[model samples]
Target chain A: MGILDTSPRVRAAALVAPPFLYALALLAFPLIAIIVISFWTQSGLALNRVFTLENYREIFSSPIYVWGNANRWGVLPLSLFVSATVTLVTVVLAYPIAYFVSFVVAPERKALWLFLITIPFWTSYLIRVFLWKVILGFNGVVNTGLQSLGVIEEPLSVLLYNLNSVIITLSHAYAVFAILPIYVALEKIDRSLLEASQDLGESRFSTFLRVTLPLSVPGIVGAVLIVFIPTIGDYVTPELMLGSGGRLMSNVIQTQFLQLNNWPLGAALSIITMLAVGIVSLVFILLNRRWLRGRA
Target chain B: MTYSPSAAPLIQLRDVHKHYGDYHALRGIDLEIKKGEFFSLLGPSGCGKTTLLRTIAGFEAPSSGSLTIDGRDMAGVAANHRPTNMVFQSYAIFPHLSVAENVGFGLRRDPRSKAEKARAVAESLEMVGLGGYGARAAHALSGGQRQRVALARALILKPKVLLLDEPLSALDKKMRETMQVELIKLQRNVGITFILVTHDQEEALIMSDRIAVMFEGNIAQMADPETMYRRPNSRRVAEFIGKMNLLPATAAMERNRIVVDVAGLGRGAIEPDQAPSGVQPGATTVGIRPETLSILFPGETTDRRLAAGTVDEVVYFGDMTYYDVRIPGVEQPLTISMKNLIGRPVLDVGAVTQVVWDERSLVVLSR
Candidate 1:
């Protein structure tokens, strides 16, 4: 009894209890409320609050629902596809930079290179995105440079107001999120392992393919999760820069609450989108664990 | 203790020198390692022993001179193309691979079937006494087992030479002693040139057939174990090898022989060969190992030179006892070890003692 009373476990629990309670009230309560509200119904401004499955039925059966849209063809799937593509491109682009930072830079200069990598983050994310908006917009940097060079007869309007521009902007905004984890994974590898591979008759390229690439999967998976999860539901980036044809699942969900005045439908759309993301994430983790844990 | 003269030299280094920016790592090293010889580069850390091993392994190229392995010049050859393999001091076992994969890592480019490669891995593992440990993760093994895995992996390729960098230093004393004997037997069984780099003097003495003792990027002395122990050429080499009590002496060459008078120990007439490096006029020293001088037992009759001393310090080991005796004229007390046999009394401090001296074992060194 004396040892138990003197132990730090009780004090640790007391210290952690505050943040745990805060998350419960702030995060968990709203999630549960969303699920509960998806099962309730609303009618015309003033209505009787009655529990029903109509909101889910409407989401599944109506043509105006996310999946039934003919041209956009389910903003849910489109958003998931866009986020996944951005994650892939960003990781492919940032891999070399992370590798260079971890291995190529001298030990004393590594801190300086990492600081340079993170310098873009000192500015606000919104401001960085807005700057990219200016660079990619019609009559922006690319069109102006091309026109002055006489390579283009007119300002290119196709560069902005498209899914390509939105993907580019999102990738730029989330570059730090992708680079840091990958850099950490690359840095965690021991130097002797690389030498051992070369000593065992592997070429530099094959050694990287077999050893360095396989061990960096955990970081790649981390970057994918970080970029994809938030980007799937990103409303502001699309609202500011996306063309009329580039509505994601979040835009329709926002419309349900603000214009449609149907909170139940909005909650239903959110629950559906969350389930899709969770399933995709779980599949990724299961595959990552199987491939990396078994081999690496 | 025997090196076969018929065995041809496998590695020849000629005036090899390596420099890193301002630091000279290896300075004009020239040596020849015979086929099937267990050679050692032994020194304290930063003596360029490891750099020399790396040069032989083709991981480092000498700055100016040339190195030839098995009669082929090794200039600009990568480690993968070289005929030598190294077991790193850290073992460098790939954690992500299995024991079998690690053992067969060098066989990836071999034009053999997978089954044949697997058999080779198994055979190498069994050779190192790690039989049937192929499927286990490399990171899961114990320290001794990891060392064995490293040995098996390096030896599996059957290179012309195998290099070990402080292989036994990571083990505890008992494990280290066991591995030392096992390593000697392994080298003999494999019958390749084994060059070990170690900072431990006793490990070098126990394991090497011939050792090149390095100091400050230069090989100070290269000799067989018995010669290194009995006849070190210089005072520095003698002190580095083991405990030696150096007595300031004056030597006079008379009739092709050197007559030396030690400060505390009496004079002796020694042959010319006893002074490996010819003794000169100025400050000369005669070295005697601790075991060469013994405290004669009471009532024992021996027709040998004797000295009188008082035991100044007593250190008792379970099997032997060391007595530090202060003779009248010696600057420092001479340490003598005696076996703790039955009925042989262990002397205490301040006890009067008789020391039996062997004049033939004395070495004249130039400091």
Candidate 2:
């Protein structure tokens, strides 16, 4: 009775309080901890607990922290390049499959096709990454098949333990994330719009370009963010296929925390990566504002 | 405007049939729409009116028949290549585009300058009464505005034939009526052949120069609106186009006339044209429109034949009131409509009355 007799505003706050506190405890507190630690100094076996900008200074001035060097690119820029490439490849490959499921498949069979798309997710992600290693390894199926067909004299050495392999693995791993949003977008399109496009003097391909593509921009934006954001911080693919060549920003952050015992530096780099992702995502959204916000 | 019967047909369909797997959608449709004619395919849902329109628009290819537009055979022609454009029932305005961009979309390949295209878009929007709305986002439009945009977009292409698939069905009744008048005016202004598909019979009757009443994938009857309404070829067509009261009767053909013994209303001699679906000498049903039968309100005099009846029910409309009168020997109560004019008192149930009906208004349908 006491709770029920409360004012409507108080009742509303009471209803919202549990999830808000849970989020503050699990999510916001850890983020706040990271922010506080990022400003601190770490000494051997102990945190100095004094606010300092030395970590940020090192990140900006250090040669190793540069995006690239004369011989090879640094981990930060390489990670950015790899994730961007992965995002592009996954989105491009996902679109036609999404289109097929949404438009070509019969209405009754659509659920089945969408369910089949999720079959890749049933296996453990690490197992999926390992499967990619097997597929793209030196003696893997592609190289062996080419060798068996006398198309190659030896297995290709460029297939694994590199950024290219990392990109390939991550692209395959996050393909479901790209496909789902795009499929939903394509599915939401009114079928009559295509006919209207054709009736308006557009050929089938031209209709796709003019009507279908423009209408699905929301889905494309969603798919781009879904595949792009978390992939920049992905740790599994680069670690599985390892070397200096395959190491990424996440790997460097892991080393600072585990090997160098410099939690503050690691936290600072983590914050920097988050900032980069936020900036990139914000810029991407701004670029697509005409498609996303204008019509909506 | 002025439609000449001798003018070559702008659109023609010969025995058009559409089969979606096993379900036959359009069956043996033969039609010709003349240039500058407002033609309608009127039917209930699933009667294949939309399918026939789609076939004409080149969205659906007929299974075993030929379609021609502007004297050219449409076989193997894609929708984009056809001289036709469609205003979809859903309006289908591209949500990502502005009103002007949507209207100008079909003009992409035109050799005109960009300024010319823009002018054409503005003109098209103005024609649809959305003149200054070109800058508005398409998605932000109301239902009626979206309809105008769709009409503008389709009309801007200036195709030889414009197909409207139940274009006004999405609007409210008043808005639909308003758009109907606007569409008729626009069609006259453009001089393009319009083939509309609709289930609303009143809309069809109001808009079409001629209407083909379809039922179960068949064109039951096709004629001018007045003929289709007054002399329906079958009881199905009669019941579909409007509220028709059918009385069981036996018709015998005399030379150039049908002598019908209509139950409850007694014997009448109708012209040969009144028996639209030719009458056999045996059993049949005669269709009477409610408006043609009026209750002889007190002091009303008419030379038409009268039948004694009791008012079983009364429904009051603002302008007209309908009475369901129970007549002797009639299977169902015969309905009579009366105008609520000055000095005419509204009749109540159980009031004794005489109903006036004309033999000229009777349509004899086969039993």
Candidate 3:
């Protein structure tokens, strides 16, 4: 008998087995290991392997400082704030570019416009982040250019080595993530809906607000989660740009595992960060569902 | 309702032209549509029928000439500012909105109270026979339901003109027929002028009081359904609107009457009105609809002109039977339609028969 004559259950198993097994091995296994380790106790140069609430107790009770900021409360909220700001900035900036590519570019030239938008990705992301470092440095591109143009009397020290520099770098680094999803959403919109809005007596701007924006909610949500989740745990931008001043949760987790030799503590921190990201993403998905009410 | 000659034209276009870069979409269109008239723009695709409708809706400005509605020139007005609404071909219902929200979309800028606008929305939905479907999601509705929602949304605005861009083309045959009757009834009840763009000639004939037949960016003919079907101005239009058997003929003007010698049906005198575009003495064509010609049974008799022919092909369509009758003189077989009744028979191919025709049914077209 041919493959088409097989039972639906057998066909479904054949179709789904590969990816399901791959995800189980690569994703679920590591997460399960981390969750188990989060509950174990860490001794000097050894792991007790005994279940204990000591790590959780210390995590909730202690107010230890990391680079002059509290590790538990201060650094976590700072990471969230920085990631939220970057997400807002990246999405807000990416929306107009996506809209231009989808609506303004001619049908034949749209591929060229999207290619140009993604040109930054041709280079390594780390290299792009280092380039932002060069651009935002005190004696770098922005300050020097402004001084040469007589717009500034001196180099501005406030341009780099702060939370702003980390935000600027991460926003630039994750720009393509925000832009691609938003562009796909905008492109999927039926152009007739815009004309219908105008026919219903709405201005072009109002039509964009009422029809185009709401229809692209899925893309916006996709972009938000894509940028927000990864940037919240980003260690590179904070370490490279902010120096020791504004280190994030990722830097602390790395310190525990590599420098402090606390595998159990690092695994616990990783679990907590994962849960935090999950909750925030869940909140965002819920908001997206609310925005997409009554839609197919 | 049909247009009245005495009333002032509600919308007038004086030599309107639209050019999209190198393509000439509309070429010097001059039109007048009266208020409360159910008018249609009918053509095959790329015939500039939709372009003319878009021009009236203020979506595309004419490259030249002036368009006016209610005596005001529509020069700089945008689509949103124009007193016109459209039901898009795809229905274009806002997928994110409920039925009520979509119907009330145009009322965003209205000065009325919120309750009054809500009531207007409800009433508009009721008019389109979607009264209790307000809370339903627009994207969840079927094709016919979405069409009704689109109609309700546009009609809620109560604009001077309602533009429909092939609104019924997406529905199934039965649903399209149902909507056609509903649209006619709605237009009558609302008293708003509806300008429908359609490629389906039958739908235009059934729905429109007057139809403008377009071909290659030009208006070929504009008349009521009966006049359009009976006295099409050109051979192309006659072929486009319905099935017309164009027989080769020669015509000569004798005083006021035109004499045409059809290849198969012989010579006959025709009135001036039989040749809508005016007949010149030369080789021409004469068109006659299939139903206008009949086949005589053995026991039947008629006062009409008769010719001896053999049935070449037969197609039975339940209630009617079409036969291709080949006469001795005509090169192409002429199709004749006959209704199947209690006593009539479906003729078989190769059967010898007498085809009945009339001189009054001849429409002469210049070659």
Q: Against the hidden reference, what TM-scores do the models get?
A: 0.95, 0.96, 0.95
Every candidate's CA RMSD = 2.4, 1.8, 2.5
Error of 2 at B270 (Å): 1.8
C-alpha lDDT of residue A146 in model 3:
97
Off by over 4 Å in 2: A1-18, A244-246, B253-257
Descending-DockQ candidate ranking: 3, 2, 1
Q: Candidate 3 chain B, which ten residues in sequence have the lowest lDDT sum?
A: B1-10
TM-score of 1: 0.95
Taking the tens digit of each residue's C-alpha lDDT, what string does model 3 give over B1-367?
Answer: 5456566789999999999999999998999999999999999999999999999999899999999999999999999988899999999998889999999999998999999998999998898888899898888999999999999999888899999999999999999999999999889888899999999999999999899999989999999999999999999999998889999999987786789999878889998889999888989999999999999998998998888999999999999998999999888899888899889988889999998988899999773
The better-scoring model by TM-score among 1 and 2 is: 2
Regions of candidate 3 where Cα sits further than 4 Å from its true position? A1-25, A65-73
Model 2, span B1-367: residue lDDT tens: 5456677788989999999999999889999999999999999999999999999888889999899888899999999999998999999988888999889989999999999999999999999999999999898999999999998999898888889999999899999999999998888889998999999999999998889999989999999999999999989999998899999998887776679999999999988888888888978899999999988989989888999999999999989998999999987999888899999998889999999988888999883
TM-score of chain A of 2: 0.95
lDDT of 1 by residue, B211-308 (tens): 99999999999999889888999998999998888888899877777889888778888877678988886568999999889998887878898999
Question: lDDT for each of the candidates?
Answer: 0.87, 0.90, 0.90
The alpha-carbon lDDT assigned to residue B309 of candidate 1 equals 92
What does candidate 2 score on TM?
Answer: 0.96
